[model samples]
Target: MSSNDSDSWGAVASSYVQVERLTTPPCQTLVNRVSLLLPLNVPNTIAFDNGCGTGVLSAVLRQQYPRLPLLATDASHGMVNILRRRIEHRKWDEVRTRVVDSRNLEGIQDGSFTHVFSTFMVCLAPEPDKIVGEMQRVMKPGGVLGLAVWGDPQFGPFSTPWEKACRRLVPDYEAPMVMDAKWTFAASVEAGLVEAGFKDVVVWEEDVPWRWDDVEAVSKYYLEGNNPGNVGMIDAFKARGGDVEEVRPIFEGIIKEDCGQKDGSIELHAPATLATARK
Candidate 1:
């Protein structure tokens, strides 16, 4: 990952920790499905949670398999610190935290883990192919690899407003590519896993609905906190001489108009893909 990407994540680490509290249900569902698919009951089971932001999935795995040894890694040191803190607070000695890049995985030994999983992190990979290769490299011969990533943004109702707002407010504005190099599509994700020497690769779609009591809550968490692409869009607009704060009202108006308030709340469907394969 680039320094800019790392810096951006570092700046948002605290906010992301808070956002995950609200956004973890879908991720937890993915984690459960992945765990069910793996032969985790085998003797001497060891696991890895790559790109473990705030350790939500790690916590779930720990609860499900208390005896399993888990190593959680993230590219951002700030995220790693938060994960470590969470682990320490929970007194989970079985789980270890590390600051490591997803693509390189510098210090991890080959064929060291029985299962490897990453949630919502593949989208940020600078080179997703390299990351997939590393995940395969670090897992044992029969190990399971699972991942989740954002599906089409068009189906994401909460995201559409920010996307439309960026286009209208900033001239010639192009949204930053979060999942570059064909990693966004299900076919490509499956192909990447296969190329990395994984077997029985299965990629499937899931729709996770996120509900907020009010637009203010939506603006605070989804817009300003969870969605990094929206934040990047605002930054890009500002860079092009646009006043983002000054245009806040207009942006909110567009969102309310597009997403239609119902019963004093807003519901958004966040579509994602969950993939699992054996190495």
Candidate 2:
């Protein structure tokens, strides 16, 4: 991650609670899958959380294995800042926090950890292969490496209705390619891990019914989340001469119509792939 990337990530750290709330279940699922593949060796196993935004993955790690020690790191200083506070408040003494880019984990020596997990963040790295290499370098010879990335359908993180609004409002609006396309493929993920010297790699698909009880709240987040993506979206709408304020209602109306569930919650398909291997 570059300095600019750090700045952009930090800017969104506060609002990321929303993202975290929406993602925690999948975080739990990924950690649970890792635990099944590589049972922890108490007092011996040390884990690394690469690109641990707001410590969402770290929290799941702690919940699933309360005694496990962790070192959570991210390239964004802002993310590290918020995570530090969370650690202090949550009283997670076994977990340590650091600000380090996943692609270049300097000062972290080779074969330092028993297990390393990268949840959803590897895809955001500018050089994902380099990040995987760094992860492999720091992990013990038989250490487990678990990873998660969005799969299949495009824009799992964004509502499809939003895409519709963009295309209708801005004739040439193309969704930003935030995640590397190649990384989204299960084969690409397994191949990358194998090339990084990991063995027994396995990749599998998972999906969750992502739900929101309130349409207004979801629309509010889209309007005010201030994440780099949301900011860029509003900018695109304005740049294309659309009524900027109309975007929120468009998101709400379309989502309610398309994804609203029977229990009065909006549901969307959130597909992701998880991979596990030995280093």
Candidate 3:
């Protein structure tokens, strides 16, 4: 990950505390899909949530399955600390949070978990293959692994323009090399689970449209969420004689024009896939 990406999360850590209200609903949608793929009855099962951002997803899981034993870990120490505090407040005795890089699970024992789950963190890594291998290594035989990846939402207003703008600006921008790095599973199958010897691989996609009532909200995500890895792209735009300050306004207008509705919310769509496989 680039400094911009790192800085964005560092900057937003305080604000993202109330994620349920500020962030959109696609998170829950992905979680629901994971829940569906889990075994019918998994009592007393040990689960691991890798790349567990602010711990919001893990916290939500605890709320849904109070008895589910979970170990939540993130690559970001800041995120782990916040999540630890959050889980502590939740009183989830079985929940343990830590900071661990996805590519290496050094301290985790083999076959320590019955199920492993992750969301939206694969593409940023230098090697998702290793991460998936580590995840599989930590799971008990017949244990399930659930992960969600962002699928290309070509039809989405925000995604369409941003992806287009990135190419128009930065010619050398490296998209993920993994087949599904852009959110399909070709790379994941080739570089991930299959390579790691996981069986019964299953993949499904869902499109969730985010409605932002405030233009500032859309601007924030653009300038914040996607901006870090996009500095090169942004600089390219600036070098082309585009007024950098005008970028935000232009994006806001685009959202207002395409996805915005009479209901005072701008619609942004995120298409993603929920993939599962058992070992």
Instruction: Note the clash tally of each candidate.
Output: 0, 0, 3
Ranking according to lDDT, highest score first:
2, 1, 3
Query: Pairing residues by index, what is the TM-score of model 1?
Result: 0.89
- How do the residues 1-279 of candidate 1 rate in per-residue lDDT, one tens digit apiece? 776676668778887754475447766776677778876656888989998887778877877777788999988888888888888888898888888878899989999998898887776568888888899999999888878877763334544676576667675765555455356668887887888899999898777776667777777664567356666656766777777666666667776776546676766667777788997
Best by lDDT: 2
Clashing pairs in 2: none
Query: Candidate 3, residues 45-154: lDDT per residue as tens digits?
Result: 77898888787668667767778888998777667777877777767798887767778887999999887887766654556677788898998888887776666422
TM-score leaderboard ranking: 2, 1, 3
Candidate 2, residue 16: Cα displacement in angstroms equals: 1.5
Question: Which regions of candidate 1 are displaced past 4 Å?
Answer: 21-23, 153-159, 167-174, 221-228
Give the winner by TM-score: 1 or 2. Answer: 2
* lDDT of residue 214 for candidate 2: 73
Clashing pairs in 3: 179-187, 180-184, 180-187
Candidate 2 per-residue lDDT, tens place, 208-256, comes to: 6666777877777777777765666567667777775766677677888
Model 3 residue runs over 4 Å out of place are 1-8, 17-43, 153-159, 163-191, 224-227, 230-236, 239-241
Each model's lDDT comes to: 0.75, 0.80, 0.65
- Model with the higher lDDT, candidate 1 or 3: 1
